[model samples]
Target: MKKKWLALLLGTSLALTACGSNDDDNAGKEPAENKETTTAGAGDAAKIYENKCSSCHAVNLEGGVGPNLTEVGSRLSKDEIEHVILNGQGGMPKELIVGDEASKVADWLSEHK
Candidate 1:
């Protein structure tokens, strides 16, 4: 009985060890097309909006903690929008995004209207 228990324990340990090796084996080898797709998705304006502004502006940009920006383009020019993004207004914080990322987000918001 003891021998059977020891054999069972040994088998379980080996099985668990084998399972853990597969994940580490694939960590460093992303395909080029996959990398391009991921990078594109990361920089896309809509994705950026969803990640950064959705919480305050609402998922559809219909407004929530912030005013509805659905027609912001009509209300503000692209430069104005960029200014606001960099400068903030009222309850919003300044410099929420910076540099090229800020410009991309601003351009997206300005065009959505």
Candidate 2:
């Protein structure tokens, strides 16, 4: 076991040193590409909205269980959205999905609004 461990260590050490750290050099060399660009377009939030929030927001946000969220982005910041999502105000149902789940929903709402 000791010999095997030493051999593995030696093999990895040589392989690692042989590979230069060019990642940093190449990173900033190219003009920034649209990393956010998604070929599928938008995201699953749209579907989530249709399935979930639709009970309230009603797509265009004419009216529903909650007030119209069409202008939610203009009114609410990402942090506010997260807060509301986690802690629920008036009648939002405190911290539903949690963590990044709320963030994804916030971003989705922001885009539509």
Sliding window of 10 residues with minimal summed lDDT for model 2: 32-41
What is the clash count for each candidate, in the order shown? 0, 1
Give residue 61's error in model 2 in angstroms. 3.0
- Error at 60, model 1, angstroms: 0.2
Please provide, for model 2 over 1-113, each residue's C-alpha lDDT reduced to its tens digit, 9 standing for 90 to 100: 99999999999999998895867766755443433222223546665456545666687665587888888888888778778877887756775545555677788777655
In model 1, what are the clashing residue pairs, if there are any? none
Leading candidate by lDDT: 1
* Per-residue lDDT of model 1, residues 1-113, tens digit only: 99999999999999999877575666887864444223335688777677667889998999999989998998898899889988999888887666676788888888876
After TM-score superposition, the amount by which residue 79's alpha carbon in candidate 1 deviates from its true location, in angstroms, is 0.8
lDDT of 1 at 7: 100
For every model shown, what is its TM-score relative to the native structure?
0.63, 0.53
What shift in Å separates residue 31 of candidate 1 from its native position after superposition?
24
How does residue 108 of candidate 1 score in lDDT? Answer: 85
